[model samples]
Target: MMMHRQYLIDQAIIARNILRVALPLQRLRASATRPTLPETPTRFAIIAGDVTDPSSSLGDLAMFSALMQSLRAQNPDSIFTIIGERRHTIVVPGIGETPVEPAWAGKTGTLAFDELIRQHHALFVMGADILDGKYGAALVQRIVAYCNHSVLLGIPATMLGFSFNRNPRAPAVHALSRLHPHVTVNIRDQPSLDRFTRIVGVLAQLCADSAFLMPSATDPITEPEAWIASMRQEGRTPVGINLNAHALAPAIAEVGMDQLIDHFAEQFKRAGEQNGLAFMLLPHDLKSQSGDVSMLQALDQALQRKGFTHVRYASIDQPDKIKRLIGLLDLAITGRMHLVIASLGSGTPTLSITYQDKFEGLYQHFELSLEHTITPMQCLTDELLRKINDAFMHRHDNRARILSHLPRVKALASQNLAIATCGHTD
Candidate 1:
């Protein structure tokens, strides 16, 4: 059944790719003339990861927040605008809710998108796996088109901090290959760098995820903070656990959601009983269906049934708060990539449940071992239990390893911004 569903998705992607190439839109062609930078303050048109969604993943929000904050810090006088649906309002981390300009006034063509780009000095696309087409072909196609339009208009454009899997869509590679030299493509990890270069036949630049630059909350909130403090007082190590349903969909399909939940619950129960560790449920996504909240609730209920009161839910409203709280943990076991970033970037030990083959490259950035990551299939067995206890037992060493390589990793993340702006400060 899963294979059939995937086959249909692949067919849809192929159909869309054929149509995109066959029916080319007007003003979407390359231009021989190039435009120079303006003497006045630059206007940046941002293509954020998730700006308009109400139930946005805190990870996506964090990446967007970090990017915007970094840009503002570098160019304080520059004007910024997010290209998104005007109907939806976006709430950034430090800066509250913000309004956005519509990507299209009417039709889905280059005329309107180009007119929008012509108003800005440059275009910045936050490439957080959205360009891969495996997630959504239409989104990847639209962003690619926008980038092509921007570069053709003589404006600097960049697809920053992105990754590609082993088998990327051919259309995405083709589209990326045809981009103007004015447009820069920055791959987030080394594996993705090699994969992209091998497929596209272009030497794409390597960088780290933008979320690594996000600052943790200074004024900590209560609840989880107080709860973690209480656990420390009792001589227990606080461990943050994040399990997202979106990443585990394959595993859920293979077995069942309940069975998978039960498996994790049993393992966590054993870990708590044997190790005397306090657990915190840290949820990143708030979507009703595929979000982490439901899975977190299920785990909480299951553990509650087993009379495990040592476990508590982590506060997850703001990215900074959750990031700050995650930093307080002795260690973390997470499925979401952003959670792993937040954990490791904070110098906290993390054991990740990796998907998409992306984590291996991320761990490579930190000079950590692949043993730090496990697959969804491994979650069903004793491997997860063994890794959890093992990670906790060697928490200090893992923390040291993460901290040792954090400086270089952060410098790589900051490089994404410099490349995106074409080395222009103003």
Candidate 2:
């Protein structure tokens, strides 16, 4: 039933593309409601994903924060308005919720949406991998429509740094291929660049992920700080673990969550004993379906049953706060890509539980080895313990490698900001 629904949706998208070319959209749009600009050149509209929602993934907030921070640094006089559904007030890290204008409610290709676009000098679609069509055809259509409408109205539009998966849906590829040449689309990694060019048949400039610019908290939270201090006092290395159900959906479906928790608990028990390591459970995503807190909590309980007292949960709400905690770790292991980004960006040795083929491109930016990543199936065996021990032993070398390549990656990340401010993909 689900596959049939997706097929019908894909067909609808293909039909929409044909109608887009056949219909006289320009004449129709010109006759629609027109809104005059406020003469504010710095006025910008940020769309896709609400940065102010408390329930949002910290990773999403991290990207939004990075974009906001970099934009402000490049142009401090910039005035901003979020263009999406209104969200509950959740303070952005290092950036409070009150300063920015409230979200303007208007869907793409509508008269109201057109009026709103005219008021802003520029429009930025926060693609962040959503344009790949895995989410749905509706989202892919909406983003592309928003960009098309913005460019037609003479306001510059830019699709911020995003990734294209190994196999993007044909409908998404078709929609993106129709984008105006004036619209600047930035693909984050080389593999995604290849995928985008092959499918969309358009030129997309390369840039690093924007989460690299996420600012760390001023100081570590008391709980994690105390845990780290105690571990060092006993001469044990602090290892941070971030696990999410989203990445291990297949494994959980096969072996159940309880068995998976038990498996990790047993491995951590043995590895900690042999390697003199203490563990920290770091939860990155907060959504119910893929939330990390519940899984990490269960693993913590299982670890306690095995008499491993060094394990603790770093319960930090803000992305920057958790990033600061990740920075303090001697080594980190995670299924969450943003957590891996935080660790590597902060010069900490890290291992990734590979998913979606996104990690290779990220690691390539650091010139690091793919040996640092493991599959979900590997987590079920003693191989997990072996990898942990190996990573722990080579922590210094990993940290040095990450630090050496940090600047170049950061500069590439900053290029996204330059693209936004300077209004060019080059």
Candidate 3:
């Protein structure tokens, strides 16, 4: 009987060891044939935000693209189990199999969390726009989930480069302090880094947004869209313009959003009449309910109503494709964060339409001149015309400046990914 009990204990310990190393094979759903691995395979979990959403911001796409590139490069042949909804699939270059269909998908939201603990080696909590503090409670909940699954369940959890910027901030910080002790927090901007360092003992390592790390995709839209063809036929230089939906929301704005839109239309109409400055009114995102397409259509109609026939709308969703499209432009004036990244990354002279501190941080990273960044509130004035014309006038020099800083920004972006995936213990 004692010998039998000893054998049972031995069995329990063996089971525990395996659970610590590999998630039970039965949990992971089978997919198309996978690449061969050694006797043992290492698996990492990437838990980012709702990147699959068609209307999702290009910034989110940019972040995910950079992350996957660096992670896959650093850990080739390692199994990647993406933790999120499995609705839409993003085709990352060189990935043979779908990174979805993980062991945890149906189990956590649909299946069970206890089932996931059985598979926990480590998890990367890659949030989307967490620093905006709009998702403070959501991020806190994620932190709690990570702590429960990792610390309590004996798995390592790491928080990648995210932001922490919220006003009336002190009361909101208690929850942030509750983040898993083992989790490494990598801040994306100097403001976030400074705030955390001063407020919390844990001064986060400052890193650039992952978007800067992404490579320009070779495949562009070969042909399509009547407006594009029409614009090309005009034989004038095509400049790209992107406006965010939220920035133009009537209810949200203190000023008359409609009037502002009209004013913008008039200014562009004036520019077009003066210099044949035609516009490719490109929408950066289409995922949100009031996404870029809605905003673009609204602005397009307003411009058309005012007799600005030179403005043509083009909606490109994929970041790579968008980058390629933006490259075709002589100049790009955009409010979309990733659009700006796309333009600058492609060595295209771009004007950044700033919405908040995020744009400031981004332009600062490349030491871009402040004159190039303008707020929507300021977009109604002569200042807008000056900035727009300046971009077109000094387009060549600006492109050179962007290219000069591209190497450094790329290095910082790569470093952000490195620290994020390194699983820092301290």
Q: What is the TM-score of each candidate against the true structure?
A: 0.90, 0.90, 0.76
Supply the global lDDT for candidate 3.
Answer: 0.61
- Over 1-426, each residue of candidate 1 has an lDDT whose tens digit, in order, gives 987886777666546644553234332434323356675536777886653553277877787678777877777776667777554567878656655776632244345455567678878887877777666655665676677666655677888788888877655665666665567888899998888888777657899998999989889778889999999999888999988876787888899989999999999989988898899998888877655888998899999888888899765778888889999999999888888999988999888988887788898897787777778889999998998888888889988988999999999998777644343211
Model 2 lDDT per residue over 62-119, tens place = 8777877777776787766666554344466765672333333222334345656677
Native-referenced Cα lDDT, model 1? 0.77
* Candidate 3 local lDDT, 1-426, one digit each (tens): 986885575455334423532232223323212223233324656665552441256666666676666666777755555555554355553343335432233224423333443463556656435533354433344343444345434455556666555441332254456555655667666766676666665636776667666666676465523455666688666788887755544423745656676777777877777667778888776765645776677779988998878777876666777777787787888877678878888888778776545566666766777788777667868788878887788888887888898887777666555422222221
| CA lDDT scores, all candidates in order | 0.77, 0.77, 0.61
| Per-residue error (Å), model 1, residue 360 | 0.3
TM-score computed on alpha carbons, candidate 1: 0.90
What root-mean-square deviation over C-alphas does model 1 reach? 3.9
Q: How many residue pairs in model 1 have overlapping backbones? A: 0
* Global CA lDDT computed for model 2: 0.77
